[model samples]
Target: MIDKVVEVVSPERALRREAARRTLRVLNSGYGNHGASRTKKSLIGWNHKGGSPDDDITDNLEVLRQRSRDLYMGGPLATGALKTLRTNVVGYGLRVKPQIDADFLGMSDEEADEWERHVEREFQLWAEDCDAGRMLDFYEMQALVFLSMLMSGDVFCTMPMIERPGNPYALKIAVIEADRVCNPPGVTSPNIRGGIEVDQFGAPIAYYIAQKHPLDSKSMQNKWARVPVFGERTGRRNVLHLMEFERPGQRRGVPILAPVIESLKQLTRYSEAELMAAVVSGMFTVFITSKTPETPLGEAVPLEQQVDVTDENSYELGNGAIIALGEGEDVKEVNPARPNTAFDSFVMSMTRQIGAALEIPYEVLVKHFTASYSASRAALLEAWKMFRMRRSWLISKFCKPIYNEFLYEAVARGRINAPGFFDDPIIRAAYSNAEWYGPSQGQIDPLKEVNAAKIRVQEGFSTRAREATELTGSDFEMIVRQRTKEEKMMREGGLLTNASENQEVLGVPGVENEE
Candidate 1:
């Protein structure tokens, strides 16, 4: 073998190499305490699997939906939260206000106004009779749809055109509950998750809907209908899938109460326990014990004779009853200390947390406005922001699509006058531009609110119509017309006075800014 010459490293280089190795070890360990495994008591068993969005949500969806529904039915807080959202988000119904683009259509202001009025009236006519079951109008259906979404996480709506003698429009709304939409038994596909079939890009292609609810005992639940996302003939969407997506590729919705189901259940249990303790304390029964083998009080009845105490060795306390015990038997007065001093504080704290999760201020959520006027107004304004956001979402997803379809059919049927609606997409969209108005935010201090609204209009920050809509849910045009008629009557009868116009009625004056 050839002589091997060993190249020895310098002392400084060796120390640098050792230091580099130590750095690498530290880097390999992880970025922080949370990123590394630890045997500490708080983190020793924290082994939860991280999953894809669909894998995490779709897999656990059913149980989550069930628990959410159960909580809504049984828990007071859940019911209140659901009701609050339903009331604020879809109160009454979202009424449509046609906003046709007059400039593009080459129409005068008067022409546009007339056209809008005609369209609104026609839409209302169709909406009144649009329900498939012939029970609820479009406005009422909005509430049902909202409540269903709150309860079931999502709701599906189908608009099927069916001929009716009295109703001019054939469009009708048929609401499908969430339970009826599911993956059919014995059917499996890589593109399908939670009954929604998607393409390679994760866009929904179709939905599989069962003929009956899975839990319905009288019907066959396994039968499913595969509905394509768009109609094969007209290229219009056949089904309206109303769901708020929370993930990039999520195919389904999580229940509104999903995040706080456990909390709601625990709070409900605590409330019930407290109520029961208070009730028991109010019974106020007296028990007598004696060393001798006789009733301490002659009028007292024996515990065994009064109640069957064999179950768990428990005694029932009755109203105005004196219980007696035998010799050597003693009863200990275990005070429950009910009407717990901390009950309200604990409950308020828990409610605040839950309300935050639900995006509802505590005052609005519980309908308790005992706070100062500023505090209450702030709570309402905050709640209204969420309400407006949800309303916008509902309008974008549900209202606009339906109205577009309605406009299309109306134009095709020659009910609405439009020259190039079918020929051009731009014309169609311009014709379909509209605003949906729901319940107003409502006033806490009417005088202050009215003054603020007036200032907003005067500063060009808002329009009289918008202020009227937001403040009182009234149309500014209608208010002006009514006011003019009243003034004419007053002038005719010589009842017109400066005081009536200056002070205004109830210290709230009309907005003078033009729309």
Candidate 2:
């Protein structure tokens, strides 16, 4: 036999190999720490592969964009998160109420009242027909389209029927499905632009909206073309692109569900497995053994001798049914897989993370309130911060601009009275000034909250108008007018309000007990 010799590498190569191996070892260690604090986010083993908070999102936006939107529509947790957010964000509908800047308009109280009435009348008339076609009114349209933005990451609105017959102000908004904004006809990609064309400043210069949805199977789908952001012959006011921009330079929106996609998939799988296991646990399997010495125990029985479950007797195995076994045959109940004790804890844990990912508290996301009052209220307060912020963004991006445009068309057509409407910017500002009120989060303890509000108002820390609007989603001025009418009517009927009666009871102790 030949002597075996171990080949030795050069010293330099040995050191290089050792360094490479050490690098890999460090990487596979499941910790990206360089002697950092254990509590530091990046050093956490679970978050090792995740990019840091400072990581630039512009580079990978396009990659995660479509898939995130798809999962938001089809994935359960994704859909729930979107629906939950949308409900809180715009469910009550941001009701538009004209609030003319009195100082800017230099109008007296009586003139301002008239101006408000005229503005409200014109606004209601236009809003009734502002939605695309005659199908949905403005509020319904807002909710539907807002849901799309939450689901698809972006939505397109076109003013195609601006000058529709019988419609005043020539203001109409038609919703275009997000998928239509794609590559130009017969082109895969030239400049890596996904329907949006941006200028050198990274500002949106034009939008390429296809006539048909990109995934539509119709034969005429190929005929759809991309339209410019501002049509040269038509005009720019015709198109509206709404997207939730996450990064400074990012062009398109990534779905709100992006962070929870993987978790949703795993949760779905776990739920399905549990359901299957539950079904199988109720089932029983048959085992047959021969009692005679001629046939060995556990020996396979001949086909002809084996018992068969005919269709007529199959019902015996069904719920609440009893069955008789063949001679020497025994029934062995199938032991169902033990339901994982950690299942609920695991699902709740996953949902908590999902809620965090969506910036919604778990209680709000699930609409569950089994927690203590303080905890529940705290969760709501925290959740409302995110919701209110999103509402502000929605107002700024979609509502406020749309209203201004509506005002422009209304004023141009003389639908609303506006002296010097076109002459001065201040007049326009006063005319366009408005507030959108949504549903109020009513107090759980009404009297306590009401007393607190009254105290705050008296102390000049709050205003009745702001508090009323926040509590009722109503116009404070309109409320006072209605209350005055009710009081007059009640006085004529010889009835008095509880507030007046309470004045008589002042300084009296236990009047009810005396009575």
Q: Which candidate ranks first by lDDT, i.e. highest?
A: 1
| lDDT for 480 (candidate 2) | 76
Question: So what's the TM-score on candidate 2?
Answer: 0.78
- Candidate 2 whole-model C-alpha lDDT, 0 to 1: 0.69
The pairs that clash in candidate 2 are none
For candidate 2, lDDT tens digit of each residue in 373-402?
788888988988888888888888778878
Q: Candidate 1: where is the Cα deviation over 4 Å?
A: 1-44, 285-318, 322-332, 497-515
Model 1 worst lDDT run, 10 consecutive residues: 1-10
The global C-alpha lDDT for each of the candidates, from Candidate 1 onward, is 0.83, 0.69
How far residue 476's Cα lies from its native spot in candidate 1, in Å, is 1.3
Error of 2 at 381 (Å): 0.4
